[model samples]
Target: MIRTGDEYRESLNDGRQIWINGERVDDPCNHPQFKPVIDIRARIYDMQHDPETQGAMTYEEQGERFAIGLRLPYEQQDWQDKRDAVDLVMNDIGGVVTRVGDETIGEMWSLWDGKDILNEIDPRFATNIERHIHQCIKDDPFHVSANTDPKGDRSKAPQDQDPDMLVHVVRETDAGIVIRGAKYETAAAYSNQAFLKPTIANWGNDKLSDYALGCIVHMNAPGVKHICRTGFAGRAPEADYPLSNRVDEIDTLMILDDVLVPWEDVLFYQHTRAASFIRTTLHRYSAFPFVQRTLSYADLIIGAALWNVKQTGLDKQQAVQEKLSELAIWREGINAFLTASVATAEKSPNGLLMPNQSLLMSSRVHALTNLPHMMHLARELCGGQICVTPDAATFAAPDTKPWMDKFYSINEEWVADDRRKLLGLARDLLNSDYAGHRLTFQLFAQSPPFAQLAAVYRNFDWQGPLEFSHKAAGLSDNVWGKGTRH
Candidate 1:
């Protein structure tokens, strides 16, 4: 069933424990740090009912409406509709948000594509996956992902050191398995559920171990505790820090202290191969939406810089134009990869259409690897004025209003108020604490750089280059390894 904004808000009051800044949070819907982003999520829900946006935000099947983001992809049009829905939501909210439901739901689809592997362990596991995928469509609950574990020491194994460092099944009850560990999850505080799974690990030759697990975790379950990191919202003035105030998604150190996972919620367990398969293929479908967020961020940065250069009359300079061209080239490079991946979409093992892995992984690398450089270029284009500009209160003060107006006003068309607004946006986008968090989130949110490159290495067609070199060089058949990827 489709949920409205009020239903989504009311769902959060289901006796979930939340903590921020060392104080217990009674209600996230009204808390300062959580309210702004919560309202954005609620607005997204309300969009599905609005006359103007309901078309793009939802789809009808058998005369009933459901969220388009939760719809299973059977064709390319489904993907396009999902893309259009995400774009509409970001535009409606006026900023970028990464961890709402759509981006993480594809992770479950990835695991679903590995049903045969899961079936080999237990047919019930595969059936559980199938049931949950549809159940999400029926429930319309806000789902997030939980992957990274605290993993106390790299050199010591879970058996040797603190076993709780990595999430493991303590024992199996008649009801389910009891799990004890913690995961770093984004948006877990206010989210309804999380697709919990293991991080990359050295499974060696073991096929069955306690460390291998995947399940659906209810956010308000008995032993789940959300120890949230300090939020950027309400700590600073919104007038000077706009994006931080509105769009910062609060992350959490979600402590799963002897939590019980019922048999119905368990997707897979005690199977190293299943864990390895999921670790490899987890982001195959999800990266599309994740990379799309980068594209929107590119537009925000470019718009900020273009406005800044225009205000300073630097748009006329050839050198300034070259810098802007560089930003555009990087932005379009991301766009090209995203477009081409879908143009040559591949069918998954389970018959779901997935973006081309090679192009998608390459796009993620291109978007993230050069993000710091692109951010620096945009910072240069926005100029030093973003840093030196006075805050909103300083501009409003009677003692300084005249001098601020005289210096900041560029022409009859440009005034102090507009100039300061632009500077605030530019600073928040490129120079603020939120900017650093955003950059880090892109860098390692999905996985680290080496893992991303490994994905490209695994998916790229090495045989094409190998065969081409063998024919071009007229090498013997024995030299090329007979169509095998190197």
Candidate 2:
């Protein structure tokens, strides 16, 4: 069933232990730091019911509605529908906000695709994944991902280091398994649930290990404490750092202090092979929405840069036009990757449609590896005004008002207020502390740069290149014995 904004807000008042800036948040929906983000997420939930967006954001089956984003994609159209739903949410919100629900929900679908691997470990585990995927559709809950664990010493084994560094099963009881450790999760404090799993890939050939486990974790569960990073929202006026104060997806260092995970919620446990399999394919479907966010973000960058140049009449200059074109090129490159990945989408082993793995993987690498450069390019286009501009308060003060207006007003077309607002947006998007954190989030949120490239390495068909080069260079057939490239 589709939820309204109020319902989503009320859901957060479940007495979850959430701390930010040394204070526990009594009501996250009203807290200055979390309110803006929570409101945005609520609006997204409401969008599924709004007449204008209802068609795009949800699907009806037998008189019951479900969030399109949570639907398991079985065909190309299902994927396109999900893509359209994400675009609809972003457009309605007027800014890019990841981890609201859509992007992270696909992580569960990726696990669902590994049902066979899970079945080998435990049949019930496979069933659990399926049930949870359907539950998300039915409940329309806000879900986030939890992968990164604070590994105290990367060189030492989890057992050797502080055992609490990584989340693990400490003991099992009739009710559930008690787990200990922490995870760095975005939007965990405000969200309903998280698909918790291991971050470590190498399980040391051990068949059973406490670290090799996956489960669903309710944010308000006993012993689940959310110590969030200080949010950017409300730190500055929304008029100045618009995106920062409105759509910042707050990150949380979620401490699982001997939290109990019910047997029904456990997807997998003590099976290194299952953990290894999940690590390899965790982002197969999720990366599509995650990278799609970059596309929306690119639009924001391009729009800001282009509007800045237009206001100053720099659009007529050849050099300025060239830079604008460069931004467009990067923007469209991401667009093409997203479009083509779906166009050439492939079927998963579980018969679900997945964006073409090779194209999607390469696109993720392309989008992330060059984000800093793209942001820099846009920053250069915005010029020095974005950094040197005065705050809204300074622009409005009695003593400085006239001077600020005289300096900021560019022409009849660009008034002082409009110019100030534009610079504010550009600054927050490209120069603010929140901007830097956003860059870091894009780079490492999914995984480190090396791991992104590794995904490409694993998915890419090397045989085609090897075959072409081998044949082109007149290599003997005996040198590299092989059949035709698959």
Worst lDDT run of 10 residues, candidate 2, spans 477-486
- Can you tell me which runs of candidate 2 are displaced by over 4 Å? 482-486
Q: Write the per-residue lDDT of candidate 1 for residues 324-397, one digit (tens) a residue.
A: 99999989999999999998999999999999999999999999998999999999999888888889998889
lDDT of each: 0.93, 0.90
lDDT by residue (41-154, candidate 2, tens digit) is 889888888888899889999999888888888888998998898888888888988898888888888888888888888899999999998889899999898869988888
Q: Global CA lDDT of candidate 2, please?
A: 0.90
After superposition, the stretches of candidate 1 with alpha carbons farther than 4 Å from their true spots are 482-485
The backbone clash count of each candidate, in order, is 0, 0
Task: Please give the lDDT score at residue 122 for candidate 2.
Answer: 83
TM-score of every prediction relative to native:
0.99, 0.97
